[model samples]
Target: MAEGGITVTIDDAEVRAGLARVLAQLGNMAPVMEDIGRTLGNLTEDAFQASGPGWAALRPVTVARRGSAAPILQVSGGLAGSITHGGDATKAWVGASKVYAAAQQFGMPQGYAGRTRRGAPIPWGDIPPRPYLPIQDGGLLPAAQSEVLAILTRALESAVG
Candidate 1:
């Protein structure tokens, strides 16, 4: 599993309380965590399919290099296809397994000074952040948070019944 990724934790008081109740009743949260992971993975893929809905548009040079009308960050679909999710009872996660995933997600600033093995600049030009993990500003986006809350609510309902 990739270590560079978002760690989703519900901070909502009501959801937390409900999760606590469910946890007490179930004694194991593996199923819920797995469901959360799958949900996050699907959301991440949706972001990719939407060409990173909230992300910056691709530079003209980048589009020209791709040589086709391919979506941003999807030249060969390696990065997006590498996205996956897994977890145990304690936690869940979704992220790309590609080595350049971090660079694509966070972007490299201009004048990064990093060089490739062939002595070329890692980023010939500035690459704006194109977050595809359903996160924004160090937290889950509102829609993703709401979906997670819904998952927790369903779990709680199942536990109660």
Candidate 2:
């Protein structure tokens, strides 16, 4: 289970309408939700593989500390591997269950007073937002939105046929 996560709701009128129609005809949205969850999970994995397409590059200090040019957010692959998705009939969600997932996804500002066990600055420097989920500004990214719309269209067509 995730303490912090992104829930992608279908805000597009056309996609929402198509989904509503399909759900009405199918009489159960669970299957559709499952499909959406799985698709989103895969997309999130792709984001990790791409090292977050639009994310800022790793800082030189971070690279040196890591001892190599390992991708940001992938030092141990825990955050990426912790990604999970699930939904009931009404909603779907995708996110990582890692404790620091929120900080990693949203970023921590510099000069914050938080400290680690050794009394060092929690982040040591600003960690720019590196959104690994296929979402932006509270909605799925354009590509992801298109993929979801395709899924909804297929479901609608199947129900209609």
RMSD to native, candidate 2: 2.7
lDDT of 2 by residue, 48-127 (tens): 88888878887888888888776778889899889988768886668787766776777877765443335455665888
Which candidate number has the best TM-score? 2
Q: Which stretches of candidate 1 lie over 4 Å from their true place?
A: 2-18, 113-120
- Model 2 stretches astray by more than 4 angstroms: 2-14, 113-120
Count clashing residue pairs per candidate. Answer: 0, 0
Q: What is the lDDT of every predicted structure here?
A: 0.76, 0.76
How far is each candidate from the true structure, as Cα RMSD in Å? 3.0, 2.7
TM-score computed on alpha carbons, candidate 2: 0.85
**Reference-based lDDT, residue 158, model 2:** 87
Worst lDDT run of 10 residues, candidate 1, spans 3-12
